[model samples]
Target: MDGLHSQQNVDLEEFRRRVQQGNDPHGPVRETLSRLGDRWTPLILMILRTGIMRYTQLLKEINSMADSPVSQRILTLKLRACERDGFIQRTVIPTVPPQVEYGLTDLGQAMVQELNRLIGWLEVHEVQINACRAEYDAH
Candidate 1:
């Protein structure tokens, strides 16, 4: 097999070993993906890649750019989840009223590179994916 297929085979083997439907429902990879798989998580994580942003800035970015806009309550939940997962950092500055900001942690920064590649792959394959969906629906 070519290198790409060979690597994918190796990855598949690794995944099989790590994740069992019954025994290991929440393996490291699976669990991590579960956290990141949420629509808001990746959006929040990626938005922080640019640098530290206040809550309103993050909210604005997601609402303006993402297909599904988030309400303040939902945004709070997603932000808390990301922070709990160690993928993002939250800072509360003490001032007249106090200010809150968010940014990526080291782990989150590393993941952004992979996220970018994943986005690129999706862009490349989107047409084929849509075509497959259309064909599948037609049949």
Candidate 2:
């Protein structure tokens, strides 16, 4: 198999093993999912993948991609959550007006790579997935 497919399978097997073994693997898995699996978190991460961005820049960038713009309060909450989870680093610059920037941490970068792998897999199997969905819907 190709390197990507091989790596994907290996990762899947490792994940399966982790989930299958031990008594409470679900707790850790669920914690991770609950932390990062929110509606806006993925989009925020995807934007951060580009480079460091100021708060307003991130807000505008995400808003451009989203059909419904996110509220400032919600954005603040997401950023705080990402920061708390150690997925993103928030840097503050003490200027006359105070400037802040956000970028992916090492952990965040690793998560982005994993997300890429999943995205690649989805791209590869999208047609098949659509076909299956259609078949199921017809039945």
Candidate 3:
């Protein structure tokens, strides 16, 4: 038991050192995950990837995702955060109803490439992930 514990500690220390060495063991990936992990953010980005979309269009797109239903208030908050982070830009048109469209900035477009890569990785490994989960649960 003590030997196993020591081995785990050594593994953890090695991971910490790797991260501290700017090996980016997780920093960039974690930062992106933290930003895009919000249920609506990625969905919003995916929707805007097609083209600029109005707030209503975003709401509808998000609603179609099914499992996670973002409320209007939450949607507003997520958009504001994304805008503040320079991930997305909001354009307000001078119209009677005040038309607002959201689109990805150049920075946001770059992020989409990263997101696409991550999604592709997940697609390839999804079965493995599910199998691991099943194995763990079976234990």
- Estimate the Cα RMSD of every predicted model relative to the unseen true structure: 3.8, 5.9, 6.3
Runs with alpha carbons beyond 4 Å of true place in candidate 1: 1-13, 21-28
Show the lowest summed lDDT stretch of 10 residues, model 3.
22-31
* Candidate 1 global Cα RMSD: 3.8
**Total backbone clashes of candidate 1, pairs 3 or more residues apart or in separate chains:** 0
lDDT of 3 by residue, 1-139 (tens): 9999999999999999866764564565555567688667888887788889999989998899758678999999889978977889999999998999999999889988988999999999999999999999999
TM-score of each: 0.81, 0.78, 0.76
Clash counts for the predictions, in order: 0, 0, 0
For residues 72-116, what per-residue lDDT tens digits would candidate 1 score against the true structure? Answer: 999999888778768889999999789999999998899898999
* lDDT winner: 2
Write the residue-wise lDDT of candidate 2 on 4-99 in tens digits: 999999999998887765346455565567756677888899899999999999999999999899999999999998888789999999998999
Instruction: Please report, in order, the local distance difference test score of every candidate based on alpha carbons.
Output: 0.87, 0.89, 0.86
In candidate 2, list every pair of residues with a backbone clash. Answer: none
RMSD of 2: 5.9
User: Model 3 reaches what TM-score against the true structure?
Assistant: 0.76
RMSD of 3: 6.3
TM-score of 2: 0.78
Cα lDDT of candidate 2 equals 0.89
